[model samples]
Target: MSISNTTNFTNPSDFILLGIPGLETAHVWISIPFCAMYAIALLGNSAILFIVKKEPSLHEPMYYFLCMLAVTDLVLSTSVVPKALSIFWFNSRQIDFSACLTQMFFLHCFSVVEYGIFVAMAFDRYVAICHPLRHSTVLTNLVVAKIGLAVMLRSGVLVLPCVLLAQQWPYCRTNVIPHSYCEHMAVVNLACADTRASSYYGLSLIILVTAMDMVLIAVSYTQILRVIYSLPTKDARLKTFETCGSHIAVILIFYIPALFSFFTHRFGRNVPLHIHILMANVNLLVPPMLNPIIYGVRTRQIRDRLLRLITHRDT
Candidate 1:
């Protein structure tokens, strides 16, 4: 609430994040689990990076893609969670104007990158299961690196416009953002200028990216399932299915809550403000925390290597 107002109107005002509105009394208690989840997300993703690097046998296209995913999760979570904790724990809720835009840029950029990684992982599985013979040749190290670079570049390029547009708008309106983080639409809404173009552009990005990635992932898995069923024996089918379980689980974890939050924020008029804001923050954090657990539990090589590292086994 410490806003500086001079008769000068050219300078952009700082944004006041209300954290989770209507739950102000419980902010300290609420931050406990938030802090725990952020800790787990950092440690889990770091462990994925460590294990994938240390184990030579783990150096395959699949594991390399996983390392990329771990890195993205680290960047995404680190950008938002600390700021959220500051608001919840210390009630430090003011964010600078340029800093807010930077936060929004990284939030959406890494989010898009994460979705792109899911698509790549799906393709990796499809190549392995559908075209087992050509798996190595089809997804060479060079190809994987290219895919990672393309995803990152695409995310950055596409998200830049949104931040730039937001910056140019005259902030003739209030500068209070109710959400924990500077979500794109929420910040853009505070502008007094006509923002219909910005609003639709943001929605288009969400729909287009989410829909395109979902379709690609679905097609890849469809081919994978067909190949599995065509295998000679039930045991073979089950084994192949096991290979995909982690990817499927991770996809579900990442997408479901995310879509829900996005949709409710746009359409669900009856939903409470606190729930809407809280879910948006939770969706981003929960996926990063759970992704490593899902992979470590489902991917046998990683689990075994993790156990070995824990036990310090030489043999």
Candidate 2:
């Protein structure tokens, strides 16, 4: 909570990103795992995109939404990690105000979009499982495309006000952001102006968006479970559950870390600053790194296609 003099508030040109301040000495070592995760995320998600595009059998709504998720994970990681690694490996810690705002915008936008995709996927599963006869008509390719576009536009529109709000503030305080990335609230806290509106807006959206999506997902799954139990055999029940395993795993990975990080940042009085910073970074990193692996392992089509693709390349 370092505050600077108000006299320096004359529209500062750039802000300094204090990347993991407590671990500055070990930043290079830290960059090793971070870079590795980024690389794996990039490669893994790319493989998903490629396989889904090449396989005509995967031209369904579920895989299309999965492809959207992969793209989001790719962009989300790219938004946060390169700059973080730069701070770690090259000591490139300074970012222009505009650049920081842009980073924050994309970081939050893609994140919102990612959650939207999860909701879309959950809806896809609900339709597929609970209404198998009408699933095709209900979630046609055109409908899926529209849903994907809507998710993108919805997130883009919602997250814009956040960055625009940041732009209005005068950064008279120490331009040093305590976290690795330029999150909206972190940047807002540096402003000399009243930030009640921005703070309220950000928190309200998080609660609203996350709660709405979680509630819808819960309803979808509840209906799905009711449908599953009506099946005549245990094998049929297990098979039905297997189809949802990847989505469940991904939802847990995505929401649990994100919600925990959000809570700790906003309310964890006893939590250390470094822990907050680390969770912020973790929320950004882990899902992208693990999502493709989860899908590849749990979803038979993706696993088979990936293995065949690799085997063909090897041969």
TM-score of each: 0.96, 0.97
- The per-prediction CA RMSD against the true structure, in angstroms, equals 1.9, 2.0
lDDT (0-100) at residue 151 of candidate 2?
Answer: 98
Best by TM-score: 2
Question: Which residue ranges in model 1 land beyond 4 Å of their true spot?
Answer: 1-10, 313-315
Local distance difference test scores for all models: 0.90, 0.90
lDDT of 2 by residue, 57-106 (tens): 99999999999999999999999999999999888888888999999999
State the lDDT of candidate 1 residue by residue for 62-160, as single tens digits.
999999989998999999999999999888989999899999999999999999999999999999998889999999999999999999999998888
Name the Cα RMSD for model 1.
1.9
Question: Candidate 2 at 104: error in angstroms?
Answer: 0.7
Candidate 2 residue-pair clash tally: 0
- Model 2 TM: 0.97
